[model samples]
Target chain A: MLIRKPADIPPSEITPRSTYVERRRFLGKLASVGGVGGVSGMSGMSGVGALAMAAMSWRPGDAVAEVGAGSLGALVKSAHSTNETPNSLHDISHYNNFYEFGVDKAAPAAQAHTLVTRPWTVRVEGLVKKPRQIAIEDILKLAPLEERIYRLRCVEGWSMVIPWVGFPLERLIRWAEPLSDAKFVEFVSLHDPKQMPGQLFPVLRWPYVEGLRLDEAMHPLALLAVGLYGDILPKQNGAPLRIVVPWKYGFKSGKSIVALRFVAQQPVTSWMRAAPSEYGFYSNVNPDVDHPRWSQARERRIGEFGKRKTLPFNGYGEQVAGLYAGMDLRKQF
Target chain B: MWAGRVAKPSAAWLARIKVALFLACLLPTVLLALGVYQDRLGPNPIEVVTRGTGEWTLRLLLITLTVTPLCRSSGWKWLMRMRRMLGLFAFYYALLHLGSYLWLDQFFDWGAIGRDILKRPFITVGVAAFMLLVPLAATSNQAMVRRLGGRRWLRLHRSVYLIAILAVTHFWWLVKRDITEPVVYASILAVLLGMRLPLHRWGQARTQAAAKGRARVTGPAWPRNP
Candidate 1:
């Protein structure tokens, strides 16, 4: 392990209340400085290229300084601290990492424009008292977007600090009132290969699926993001709706969502079904549980120059840490 | 080849066709290299270039292999003249594709690069294809041909069949999804192999039947005088 000294940073350390107002102020400045620039300009694309090239190496805490506490907001909630929410999760319901439309990380930002997010409805059925179709617009009106900058980790071992905008997922589940039989919440994405080229892959079937334990789904850290970067959710980023589970690998927080089903048994996930030995539920980023192939100890924090130290529960241990206090993460993994 | 060198050159039309065929074999490689240099190889240029060079390498090899049957069947002996050039082009792109992976992905760090070549299944197959190409490339010249003689030269270059198979396997393993491209290359290779079997048989049968009928009549002198 490489030890880093925070004293290396030239500025005063941030502590106490890291509030929404402060995040907004910082976000505004970061938009001008840190953003690759709005997707509209060619300079912005070059900016992405330039960053990808320069970021081959890194200095510690560069992301925290640039993007702010990133996943700290949602993690703080997971940490069960009411005082701080993530500042980077500016608009969470939408910003996503779907690459089916194209290969560019930013492609989803534009390619998702081809998708129709309206006139949308979700069939919340299976072991639920309220097995009904709910208009997405009505669902949006259920609660206003709030900020939760969650630590996002990918199976590929890279990560990003995203400030997502949405209400706690538990809020809606409580209002819907699942019966005692409901044990899992399975999510389904739009599966058309014509729309999602990832489906055409003989490697893995399309219409990606994800699931979580009902109790885990209700955990305060789980969110239904509505927007990002202070804008309505971009279509490519699962516009209109998506889930954010702050502590797990990114795939568990599925994208381009079309359905959410409450099931009694644990649902089979596509990645797990494709390669069972490699992926597992409770895919919490436990540094001790190495993936079949890679080390989970360190991750490339995207939007930052180099790799960062991975924390227990992605640095959210103060709250949800005790939830797994006695459990063996390696077994669950 | 010793006696053939003393014979007059083939017709003018044959020479022009040989030149045209060489240009055709070279054009895609030149275009692909241009695409690589300019970073115009397409979105995810590394993956695109990877697939492109690999596919062309297999295709040129198939064409070079087919020259034997095509020349025999069409009775165009001149078709053999273009075979060596096409075989070399296949090697040229195969080397470029392997070099790109080493230079760009591995950054030429011999240790990690060696680990990738040794540890990964796909990389191992790809390296095997490259090693097979080395003998074919070396013997492609006239001096080596004279030294090895035609029979030994043909036997050594038979490694082309195995190289094409290994290249296809390398392609199949690299893709995370959509193996249609690799499957298509595999199908073409299978057909190219099929074209060789009856071809050598039919050519030899024609040569021997002429000699056989004359021998049956007079217990073996020559055919035309009778």
Candidate 2:
């Protein structure tokens, strides 16, 4: 009966010396460039410039400018950013629930290297007025990438604060120009088993799909993330492109998206198809409404000990509460 | 009864093997301790520990159940000596699994734990399995066996089969998807439980044969008709 304590990471180890210095250097560079508004001047920048400014203000301690085949030019700090500290990049990348690589938490990091992110194109079709295939390169430059630190609450009773670099999904939806009749948006992940071994298994139907109400998709809080921690997203963390719906369960935010379909009807998501009784269409984070298998009232935040009381909508009630104001969360959940 | 007798190991050899088996049974806990000490349990150490202890509990329970059939088929009577120890070790791991949930996962929050045990079917079955193991573990000693008599003791201990089933069901219900691990455990348990059916029938046949033999020697209580 050896009672050893959980790993006690020192402050220095949490943010490595190199990362700390790099963050300081980036902040100093932002200050030296007087023409470009510094952190405070981000509000003054207009259109995509504001987003670029926000990207410039992004201070991932160990920010890497280049990711895979592309360079993430500048990331501005988003007004939507959560004040909570983001989990370490190691923990964030190493521990994931991306089933496309494998079901095990550690499986993605090990098996995701085989995935080919480049030469990727997302098809935006269905009820959209202007249906088109958007290449990954063009998607990255579609809008100024902002650093949005959001609380990602998984359906499995675990939570993490992630600094995601991407523009709002609204931007992409606008580009696609969905028809007025489009009620829901469906995201289709890559279905190539040759690239994603997990696809070989019929785990929730291949080409993992997720959906959102057109309004939820248009919410400013819903982001199409390209990178995390100011660096290009690792393959395991859904590299190339993924959606981030902060208020909903992490599974609602589809990863490594290959297509966006604007549909007139509510699309049957992968998880909903897998277990309709457990997962619902909305999948918003409601602490009161527990998952059928486990309690959702409390959640264990990554890198922290003990559980904390889970907040309704993961504490994003202020922003997204209106969307579900009259709806029955329990019924939807 | 199914196979020819195998050579029994020397007492000294048996003792050494028992010690090795004891250490082997304890290895999972040791590795988990090392993981904690070295901080290698990853970000979610509690989860790792919880799952590790629970998996070992199920495995040890299945291994303990294997001894009877293994000994019967292999003609290794010496293995029977290890069954109690193995069963006890299974209970030991069960205790650790429950301890981790209560102390680490719930932090002795009885209200939360109670709600989980009552509300969640998985936790309910898991707690039920552990509760049933308590009586078996208590009566595992020679004294309790002697006091209760072999027949009653055996009947009481038969509950282990139910406990094993409950443990597997608990695991089956808890997994979100990817039931491969639970399915494997359940299959092993199914095979172990299935093996007992023939042995039970054989025992029943033997008892009937013994009773007929006694009647033939002692004569029928009532005289035969002319």
Candidate 3:
């Protein structure tokens, strides 16, 4: 038998584990020493190109400061939090499916800079007793924010474990004081074409909309997110306000939301409007209920090489599965 | 006559052009390798590589289809010499695409991949397109051409039309929304297919005219020539 010594290995093939393990720390140090200009200079490139450049040059620590300035303050860790190591904030922010900014995964990060998250008001109307526009500042004070790490499953067979900072949607719904007739709650996103360039095209219905059953909306698991990674939300990740419905597909969590309407009828979401057969009203995450174009049984978790078995209700079935009770997930999916 | 009127490059010039074309075809793979080496493929390198290789496969297939039309329009008969190489490059990228899916995306989880190919329409069509290309790629050599004879080989190669359609449909069905890129490729494929209609008719008409001329010269064939 022939044995090769450690010294025989080429230096180029061996990257010290410590160098990669402390890569973010090294990048953070690099950022402090004039790496900010490189990130800013990448803005002129195409969306995916810019994201690639940002991924290479920008430090994850500085990304929070550059985008949100840590406006969210300290968050209490929730019992509902998953133990999984959440995807890097760079991955969560840079690779988004916020179609308001653009349809491409990287478009939101590149184009959402034009979005004005401030001076934002969410109109709480429809079946609510008091139909009025609430300022974002007032909404932030509704409940104590908590960090709940959850698995976000996209319909495209990709998944991400995100550490989201927000309070329950039940708090916001209770604050609104919905009438008894309110059976469903529809979330509507901002619709300014100038800010969200993708809205200029009719790829999806303008002013993207999503909805949930009254019981689903009242579920403690449903979160009204304002921030992520203990920082205020980046414009690309739906700044000001967004919903995080962990049990459902990621698209169900509407971003850059400007309105929350309590309605009696099941709202026709933008996805449902575009392709009724593919996207349904009750988009609960189910591995058994495969998407028409691809399988939902397995998913490629971002930053990971191989796929893992996608769980039913994204592995929150114990808590939220009761909401669907005896319904057919396949038909709904 | 028009083809003769055009200037043909010398053997050395043609060889250099072939070399350049081969390198040009290999550029995407080289860049992809550099991306992997530099760790510039973003958070999901497998997804990037898969998508990149798949896209290049479609692009090269479209470029391969364009060669015939270009030769017809420009009377550059030499262009056809590069078609098989372009087509094989497309096959190479397709192999890389499948390799990424099997090795990187699925990690050799044959059961999962089998289920996906069976259950998913996108995967089914993509795999079908790749499978169809296998025989075409296998027979791309001059030895196989001589073994099968030109007519049978040509007939077998015609399946490329079906492969192209399946490849486009694979892309079209995979997208969730915003079908702009797929639409653009589909339109190019449509134009290429449409161009073949007129060329096929022209070839048929020329063959019929030649047959008629031959018949006119060999009149009264029923009578004994001796």
Top candidate, metric TM-score: 2
Model 2, span B1-226: residue lDDT tens: 2233234887887899999999999888778765553346776777897899999999999998898888777767788888889999999989989988887688899999999999999999999999999999998898898898867887888889999999999999999999999999999999999999988876667668778885333322211100
Q: Can you give the lDDT of residue A161 in candidate 1?
A: 59
Q: Model 2 captures what fraction of native contacts?
A: 0.49
lDDT of 1 by residue, B112-220 (tens): 6676676678888999999999988998898897798766876787778888889889888765445677899889888888876675576457658767874232221
Report the lDDT tens digits of candidate 1 across residue range A1-333: 122222122212224333443544344334323322321122334655645533432333443354443331332222222232333432222234575675435456556666777778766777788787778777776765575556677666566656566778876676566789888888887777776664555455566789988877887778887765445566766767888887788878877677778888888887788778878977887777766544576665433323566777776665466557688888888
Question: How do all models score by TM-score?
Answer: 0.65, 0.86, 0.85
Model 1 stretches with alpha carbons more than 4 Å out: A1-114, A142-171, A191-207, A215-223, A244-251, A274-333, B1-43, B203-226
lDDT of 2 at B206: 65
Candidate 3 — which pairs collide? none
Docking band of candidate 3 = incorrect
Q: Taking the candidates in order, what DockQ does each have?
A: 0.09, 0.21, 0.23
Please state the CAPRI-style docking class of candidate 1.
incorrect
Where model 2 places Cα greater than 4 Å from the true spot, the runs are A1-71, B1-6, B214-226
Decreasing lDDT order of the candidates: 2, 3, 1
Could you tell which candidate, 1 or 2, scores higher by DockQ?
2
lDDT of 1 at B100: 62
Candidate 3 lDDT over B27-60, as tens digits, reads: 8877776565345666566577789999999999
lDDT of 2 at B15: 91
